[model samples]
Target: MAGRQGGHHIACTGLSAFPLTPMRDDAVDERAFAAQVARVAASGVDSIGALGSTGVYPYLSRAERARVARVTVEHADGVPVIVGVGSLRTSHVLEHVDDAVEAGAAAVLLPAMSYHPLTDDDVIGLVETVAAHSPAPVIVYDNPGTTHITFTQELYARVARVPGVVSIKIPGVPTEPAAAREHVATIRGAVSEDVTIGVSGDPFATAGLAAGCDAWYSVIAGTVPEVAVRLARPALAGNAAEADAENARLAPLWQLFTEMGGSIRVIAAIAELLGIAEQPCLPLPIRGLDGEQRRRVAAVLETLDHAAEPDRDE
Candidate 1:
């Protein structure tokens, strides 16, 4: 790991997760947002991902994203803030990367979002375009759950070899253990094991860590970070059993947000319930959670808090 490439290693080592901050009439409640980041940072989270899928990235204007990134970085002090730069076009996303870097983000996380499915060559080209233009190191996000396509191990290896590409964020596709381990072993054997492979989904983070993934990029990390920090840090350090126990405790909240119909929308609503944001406003076409879903989600959150406390004692 010691070479010219080794200098960028720090960008990939941390727990990268975003906080969902609900908006009130197209405006962010900065006070609430800052407090949320501060609380998460104080709980020992490695990095804060602002203006991400959890943070309602699609709803914010470019200017709003910049301001939120700046404020989040300010509140986090020395903690790294990885700003999302996912957009419809390369130029627009590149500009967002510029704004993120200017706002003092340590790195920029980007999704592969070109029209239609992308080939390995296309994925490599897209990663190169962003890495070449970004002011900071680029972390490629492979989220086939939301996005239409995911980069293959061949493409991931190629991009990992790129000059400015330091990290890759892969969502854990399997919700079960045997399959999850297979997914990790396959990817680790395919890519340079030295390149940091981060798991994004909550259900898969523990399994991903147990299977030797370097870090986690989680949305659940945003709302109830104490649980994420307490559990994930140990998992990354190679304690799979303890990690799984913690995951079991928090599984209800994870299932509520992700397993339900409107995962993203439900998350926004929960952010409001937790008092982290004023309103649960998503981008156009992504509506708020229904009343019944909100009640169920709230009930699960209570269980998460109760379950998390005992695990911390362990």
Candidate 2:
């Protein structure tokens, strides 16, 4: 459920689905992207993360990103949209933030999108700068894999103090229950009580939520949202056994994520397979999954065919 802080509605808690910014040829497939947004919004997820890493944030141009943000908010159908506004240059990130707010974003996810080695202070400064100017609340995105910027507990604490920061999207957490709890507990101690902690890295989602994360910033939720919701609803509701059972059921898919590299390509493959987006929908250079790999994804999908079926339980 979403919580209100003072006046701002913080929709950072629960499952926040991240949809692909589907592309056709070299340009953004606005129609396809909007459909993805509409699909996720209709899934009853708590929020929609428009342009996180799963959405291929770095590859898109400012204009494309602005259009994607506009399309996401417009199609989200009142679902809170958290647009990612991370860029190489701080100024450009702020500009993206402006575009996102203009497009009706409820919050912004700012990763330390770095090319050069960035000091901790540099990252903190970037957050402070954007938070001061951004009309929407900020989500400190600690995505070390893409950003190559590992945020220490101290770094998280320092940035969470920024006036407008409302959430922190941690990359992942420990798989073991005790370890995951300790890990999330340390970060929880560092931020404000109201600053929601959302877990990325879909495979670790149940563990993270079980360990006390406020949300699941899910990649798989973008393509096969009903399945994601199946797990997330139980997990967020404190149904540990049901959540763990669902996690075990999706073990094949999670293993595929590792075997295939990461969620980006696998999810793109799923979207294409489901006819939710076009073939070769991802931006160029990232050819998505190859034919053989796609076949494997297809096989996996067959086993999880229930994903495409309606959630009659709902």
Candidate 3:
């Protein structure tokens, strides 16, 4: 997996996180999305996550997801774009892997599949299946909070050995320093340090850096890519002071997302406030923010210097 076959060493090193693009009226706002990607890339993020949970992969039709993926890669310049290929059906996920390759993504990220409370073998099979089909590389995304299937240390080690399996996206849960250490050990033991370990959690990204994770995958990056980039740079460079200050500024926003439900709502709120798209077009049940919640999110966005425009009627 480490060869130089027209692919660079997968740079999962800095602020690389999944970003949700707010959709509108059964179509993604192409103009707005291009602008959003350009802004995120300019903010110093190391990677862009397309069709992730935030991107509402489950909600979009196959073609729509492909369009988003293609547009994302085109606008990302050289930044690595991790294509989300998490689908319940193995065939569908493989199809997405092909799409990622065609769209020129650097890697694929997939959540642990169907087997709720998946066994080691179950996790291994899923990882192996996706790894076999992915053109670039694949990262096993382990988020028990959403997928309801948890891959233990032994299971992770087994999957890590799969061909083309190059990274692990672990939730920075139980966010204590000790917990982060245990996770890093678990992931590192499963694969060589060559296989990156990406921590995902608002506080966990910062905590994981302290715990020695190679990279971080976070939702916080969607709202404030600059803050996320600043936070990651200091830690990656071994500068604790700057990292801590950056995290301090991000803490309130983290609190806001958690208190206001979680990543989905926070992403929707931010997209609305930024006016990047008309409405947060989450599939049924994941609707736009209510009046009070909108006010709260607006307050948070007001603190940032990023450009904001009035909502347009379409």
Residue 260 Cα positional deviation in candidate 2, in Å, after optimal superposition: 1.4
lDDT of 3: 0.74
Pick by TM-score: which candidate is best?
2
TM-score of 3: 0.91
Could you give me the TM-score of model 2 versus the true structure? 0.94
Give the root-mean-square deviation of each candidate in angstroms.
Answer: 4.7, 3.9, 2.4
Q: In candidate 3, what are the lDDT values of residues 1-314, reduced to their tens digit?
A: 53211133456666786667667676777777776777676777888887777777877777877888888888887777888888877788888888877888888888875644566676778788777766678878887767888677777777777878777888765556688677687678767666778888767677788778888786767556765776788877878678777777767677886787777887777876677666665566677787887888778777765543544656
Ranking by TM-score: 2, 3, 1
What CA RMSD would candidate 2 show? 3.9
Query: Taking the tens digit of each residue's C-alpha lDDT, what string does model 2 give over 191-297?
Result: 88978899999999999999999999999888888889999999999999999999999999999998988888988888888777778888878888877998999
Count clashing residue pairs in model 3: 0
The clash numbers for all candidates, in the given order, read 0, 0, 0
Worst 10 residues of 1 by lDDT: 305-314
How close is every model to the real structure, measured as TM-score?
Answer: 0.88, 0.94, 0.91
Candidate numbers sorted by lDDT from highest down: 2, 3, 1
Worst 10 residues of 2 by lDDT: 1-10
Candidate 3 residue spans exceeding 4 A from truth: 1-9, 115-117, 305-314
User: Each candidate: what lDDT?
Assistant: 0.73, 0.87, 0.74
Write down the TM-score for model 1: 0.88
